[model samples]
Target chain A: MTALINLVYLISVSLFIVGLQRLSSPKTASSGNLIAGLGMGLGVLIALFAPMESGDDNYLIIIGALVLGSGIGLVVAVKVLMTKMPEMVSLFNGLGGACALLISIAELLNFHDSGTFGLAPYLTTLLALLIGSIAFTGSLVAYGKLSGNIKDSWKLPMANMINIILLLTLIAASIYQLQALDTMDLVYFIMILSLVYGITFVLNVGGADMPVIISILNALTGVSAALAGIIYDNMIMLMGGILVGSSGAILTILMCQAMNRSLLNVLAGGFGGGVSSAVQVGDQTVKEVNIMDASIILRYSTNVVFVPGYGMAVAQAQKICKELEDMLEELEVNVRYAIHPVAGRMPGHMNVLLAEADVDYSKLLDLEDANKFLNDTDLTIVVGANDVVNPSALDDPGSPIYGMPILEILKGKHVIVLKRGMSSGYSGIENPLFFHEKTSMLFGDAKKSLNSLLDELKTIV
Target chain B: MHLIIEILTDHLTILFALIMAIFLGFELISKVPTVLHTPLMSGSNAISGVVIIGAIILVRSSGSEDYISLFLGILAILLGTINVVGGHAVTNRMLQMFRKK
Candidate 1:
């Protein structure tokens, strides 16, 4: 019977791997999600057959929890706005972390009850509890930050010092617990401290670093889950957890590379928080263009590219952006969108927003392709984007965002910036791109500006 | 000492499984396009919901009189189910928008 169950688990693990592989592309992604969900269902079903104490009400409790959880999850999944996806993903990640934390606590209590004193069991249990607690609270804080409930700049004074001390204390606590397993209080103490550490660890990180932080928390949750599997000797959980853990780690590295920042730099916090050093533009004067002239340029341009940022998401202007793209296409203009990897709050955020607006994924060009296209493009419209297109990232070494890659919007024949004001970007770095000779600012709320621009284009054609 | 060694020996296969899974995990999504990063994130997040299995097992193995264990186990199941259900559903919703038009 055990061997048969293991066989089923093996098949489920295979499906998870295949599902993840399929998810690497857009065409198979949705079905791949379903396939992974199917694997989860099989794993859950088989777990029911595992040997257990004969409690008649256990099945009832399990069924009730599953139903309630599924109903809430389904409702939120269907109704959440695409603009709020980062927050939604953060919330879901928190719940997974919380689940792992609770599992560790429950398992630890069981071990205490049984008076089990093995080295491996206690070690795994402590690791799970520590990591699980951290992932749970760290994720919640991240969700709060993303949702605007918590300030992006909020952090404890001496945060790095505090974090190091907490980490050291946790290690000392773990060693003590290992040596003296007589009481459960030490376990509870470690849990509480770990939770506090999670909050401080994430609180120090700036808003722009959310993609890396979210990915790290996701990987932490996976590690905790694997630790839980280790405690219970569950092969399926171990397989699934390790897969998510490693993949999430890779994703975190990818996000860091996109910003040209090391993981250590991000975790040290305050990258995009304070005002950066003043880098004087050649001239303080920026050329401003009216809607009519901008429209005229768009009308006659043979090729144009749209660059979007978090501001686009903020103004809820993606649909308008898409509409403008379609109109340009009808006028025989070759329109494409240049998507910076870290453009929005999370990874691929701009892509998701544009996709939600019904823009074909094929119309979106990544960093390299977009830069290449920009060189030949007659006009480039930057919609509510700042830092990602800032030329300072290229030439200004003293700039906060110097090493980061940006869309070479200035390479185009003409540039129209749709912005609300002359304020610096999230990293608080001044953009010389605004003052460049070829650049023109069309100032207004992004959605309103785009609406007027569209109206102007309509009159021209 | 004997018990400790026994536990380590017993975990040898599980350790092997873990090491192999980690290597495979790194190799699996190494070359994903930037466009699919978000969905890839949420999808793997759903897979981590496999902890729901352990939660179920925890609940089953707990005696009826063990109220704390039962409560914690059931809560784990609830949260795990939400992660699995919500993560996958959201990822699918996002992926559905990526048409080739």
Candidate 2:
């Protein structure tokens, strides 16, 4: 490598590190991403400039691929809705996995003709191939689930067991190939099994129960890329892969902590998917509140808190929620948003939704801070949210989500819940908080309900 | 045999570096607040596209590549490029929403 190329690589690595550091804070996150992107662009530019064994036609092909890829990326980033961001992320991640998988395949073919292969690169090739195929196929499955193309319940019985068997088969094939003299059959078999295993593995995970990080199969892509980098001795891939691998792991641990679930349970295709063992029967009636009464309560309150959940996402009520917050703030009311760690389908889903509506980040409070303010608040608005604020999570020992930390919206002096009906949450756990005397149900779609409340507030104040 | 030994040491070096990177990665993004979580996830997803480096190395090293290998190399390059460009662009778009005004 030329000195100039080496210096650029070093600069790119620095940019990645610095950008990642900035991403830890919302204030600098935009600039951080730009910096990292600049680094990646520099790397791509150098790759084009560097000499390759291919003829002039190959250069045309490379540039063509880059342009085609960038066009697709640009369209996806610029045009896709924020609500579908997770699905887009998973699809792109799948492509990255495909990159690694193809690299390993290319290298494996190279080895077949060379008649010589080192142990280290050989092992790296196998590892990359295994993990890469899994990441690609698994990410596609995840994208399907997120996009509702595949039903959540579409899973073979004992699919997890089948996955383990396939995994063992892959390992045994690789081991057998090592003992046997040069043969490409085992490697090809391993690749097929890995791709098949990926599908079967994620198939069993019901969408609602899928863990935030592991569900999308992000870390696996990074793992495969890092291994592939080792095989080829590529520093850019090495650094980027390890960074993603660790970052994804960290997020997984954090999401698990927030959900109060064991990492093992998450990896075992998630728990509490179909039926709940802790169903409760209650005869208490739920009080219904109209927009007029709800707005009156809100207008009079000194402090109000908002607890949003998946229902908000489903109804697309984030914009109205922001409007309501602004209206309340204008009425000299102290308004804040209380966010449960697992409030939405994924980690930080609600935050992203609200941010899209240009809600101030500072007004967003995590579960701990929200708990402190809820007790003193005069009214707490629960919008399209259920389990996250369900006192059942805190008090009902027999509830499936009993031990999970919730928003504690029940602690407020008065609570208004906007819901389509008195249905159970994603975990199939019924909430007793709906029937509490302090809580009043606002039965409707979240967006319409919030619009009504916003209109009523304007009229009253 | 000497060349093989050198290669083994290089792999070992990469292995050690990977181990340390994992720890450092954990430490850096440990306490990221809920609001920044999606952006961070998107950022890391873009970083995963670094496999393009491996793709380039494979494509460049092959002296007399056949049609299948070349096709696969092009496919890898395409996918890697998509990942880097789309991932980072989407992340920046999302982050632009949250950067405090």
Candidate 3:
């Protein structure tokens, strides 16, 4: 029976690897997801059907909880919209953490009952408890911030200083607890500290940095789950946990590089708070163009590049934008999309958004590649995007987003920005690009402006 | 002395397993493109692989007299089920959208 179970574990691990590999491309992604799902389903079945000494009504309880939990998860997963995707991801990640936490606690209770407490298992349980609880609370806070249930930023004066002190105390107390070997009180204290740290760690950060926060928290949960696996001596858990942890860490590094920010800077968390109200535009004037006029410029353009951000997703304008792209191609306008690594609400969000519009994957150029074509492009349309293209990230040292690499779309000859108002973007930093001489603002709703642009282009030809 | 030695060796073995897992973990996900990060997040959540297995083993090992572990075990099962079932379903739904036209 144990060997059969291990065989099932091996199959599940291979499926997970294949699923992750196939997820890299558009064509094989769905089948990969199906394969991974099958593996997980088989794993659960083996666990459920394994013949064991059934206690009175134990199987019933297990089945009941399983059904109830899964029912809730499935309903929410299906019902959540694309705009709410980040929050949902964070929500599910938290649940995974809670699972690991509960399992570790269960182990601790059983070990105590059996009078078998070893140093290694005990320390691992404590570690799992600590990481798991933090992941739970941290993910919840991330969900709240993404969904606007919690304040993205609070005026916690010296928050960084306070966080450092709290971290030190947590470490000191953990060491003391480990030395004394008095179990319950110390475990509870560490759990509480972890939960509190999770809250403050996210609270000090504003909403703009949510994707990074969520990714790192997911990695923390992975590490915790791996620890739980260690306690249980479960090979599947250890392997899965490591995969999730490493993937998250690697993605975090890539995203930080894309933003030109350090992982340490991101964790420190005071940068995304609010735009300073005292800033000036330094004598640059704003330009406005009508839909017909904008269409004429785009129609005659030799090369056009589209840069999208979260606002495009919120406006659900990707389809219409794709329609415009098709029309431009009909006009023999060389068009391509420039995607910032951290463009949308989450990493890779813009890709999904554009992919949903049935945009060809080959046409989407990453940041560096897009910049290569930017200098020669005739018209650059900023569609409901602000921060990713904001020249302040490049030019102004005083700006909070300074040194963050951005699409140098100002290199284009003519630029039109479609936005609802003169609001600062997700980072709440003022965009000097909006005031640039080469840029023109077509201020309105993204979908509305996009429809207008497409209509005018079609009629002109 | 025998029991102490056994426990210490067990600890060492688990530690070795952990370091190896971490090393193997970093190697695999480095090549995943930026475009797939969203699906990757949702897909890997389904990878909460151990929760179900661990919960099952915990419950099976719990003597009928241990109600506390039984309760915790049930809770673990519930949470693990939600993560696995929900995570996979959502990931499939997202990946379906990525299919070629």
Candidate 4:
């Protein structure tokens, strides 16, 4: 039975590696998921019966944990929409960090060997405690911003200076506590301050930089885990900790580079401002087209491309998009969707939205593939998308979003934009995609505009 | 009975980490794009190699343990080695697919 348990543990770890590997590839990711899950289940089974633990009452604890955890997990799984996934991920990370912090604290109190509880253990624990607390609280604040539990973005006069002060204070406190190991109270007080600082610091950050922030928090969680493992002298914990810590650090660096910002810039709350508001386009009123007028333009077009963004998600217009696609196809016009990498709030936000409305995945084209098609497209129907299609990413070098590649919808023969108003996008930029010579603004709710367009399409056909 | 409880308490963190890793791993891989295929796969593969370090530490520390535990730890190290090597190889292959500036 002991041999069997060891074999199971080995197999479980192997599956975990394979699952993570498979996840990187699109083709075999789902299978990788199943394999990883199976590994976890097998590991639990081995642990349950392994000779290392000798409790007859184990069945009760095991069943109780599974029931409680699975039940809560099921509820969260079923309730959360794809749109809320980033926030959900933050919450999940917070829980993990919280666990690491709690375990470390517990281990400190139960420290058996006085000699081993010297400088190294104390320092690692202090570092872990500080980082983990920050991760926990910072993730919560991030969740708040993403979930709209608080104002999405705010600015402070000297936010950077304050963040630096708080960080220095936390570090100083950690150093003080390292030498004063006998004084648990001071250690805890510093931990509290650091944790609070972490919360406030993260709260000051806007929603746009959340992806990288979450990755950073994840790395913190790993560091905390490693520290806890060292304190407890646990091999599995150390392995898991090192893995999470290094990978998370690398991921944070990668994410920071991808966004063209430094880790310091990210920490200093210097990264994102809102989308640019529409500047003075004096005396030029945006031309609005009713359904019939819009269809008249659509009727003659040889090729049509639809662009969907966050507004499309808010209005749940994906179904209507497919409806419009089918209607346009009936008129012998080719229709395609131009998807930008960062089109919606999170990565793949647009794809998930489209998939929910049962849009054919094949019609969704990546930015590179779709960029070539935009030149040949006769009509570009933009549905509630803004900054992604902004022309400033190209023509205006002075613009904040200048370097980011945008879909060249202006190249199309005719462009129709669906918007609620001239309100800025998440990046706070007013798009010139709204002001193109061939563009006609159809201002309303995305779904309503599409419904009206559907009626108009019937009349034109 | 007490010994069993001790074991469970000691290893609780490891157990939870495994569960969380599995869950998060599944959720993430399900949605990766074809463009990110190489990096994502290789990253996860490399991550798996953490098991090797864990095995080494366990084997080195458990000086008083029976031969069975030592054997199992060695097995873990071997498995972890496979992950590190294979994961790095795959990642390098994937990186080659991208056009370099």
Against the true structure, whose lDDT is highest? 1
Ranking by lDDT: 1, 2, 3, 4
All candidates: TM-score: 0.96, 0.94, 0.91, 0.75
Cα error, candidate 4, residue B84 (Å): 24
| Model 1 ranges off by over 4 Å | A53-57, A272-278, A281-283, B1-8
In the range B3-81, model 3's lDDT, one tens digit per residue, is 4576568867666766776676567667777678888877776775346667777776676668888878878787777
Best by TM-score: 1
Candidate 1 lDDT tens digits, A126-218? 898898889889989998999899997577888889999999999999989888888889999999999999999999888878889989998
Residue A424 CA error for candidate 4 (Å)? 2.1
- State the lDDT of candidate 3 residue by residue for A1-461, as single tens digits: 87887788779767766766666566777887788777667666776676665444366677788789889888978888766778888888888888777877787665666666877677788788888888888888888887777865453677788789878988888778766775577667777888888877877775556668878887887788788778777666777787778777777887788778888788787364554534487565688989889999998999999999878887899999899999999889998999988887677888878877888878888888889989899999988778789787776777877788889998889889998988777666778788888888999999999999888887999
lDDT of 2 by residue, A1-461 (tens): 78888798879877887888888887778888888888777776776676655544356667788889899889888999999877788889899999999999888887877879877687778889989999999888888887778887676887777878998898899878766737788888899999998888877765554446443478888889888878866666787788888878888877777777776666576655554545455677899998888889999999999888878888999999999998988889999999887777667888999989988988899989999988899998888777677677676676666687888887789999988987777656678878889989999888999999999988888
lDDT of candidate 3 at residue A101, scale 0 to 100: 79
What lDDT is reached at residue A362 by model 3?
Answer: 81
**lDDT value for model 4:** 0.62
TM-score of chain A of each: 0.96, 0.94, 0.91, 0.86
The 10-residue segment of model 4 chain A with minimum total lDDT is A53-62
Clashes of 1: 0
Q: Candidate 2: which docking quality band?
A: medium
lDDT for A134 in candidate 2 is 94
Runs in model 2 with CA error above 4 Å? A51-57, A214-216, A272-279, B1-10, B63-65
Cα deviation at B40, candidate 3, in Å, is: 1.0
In model 2, the clashing pairs are none
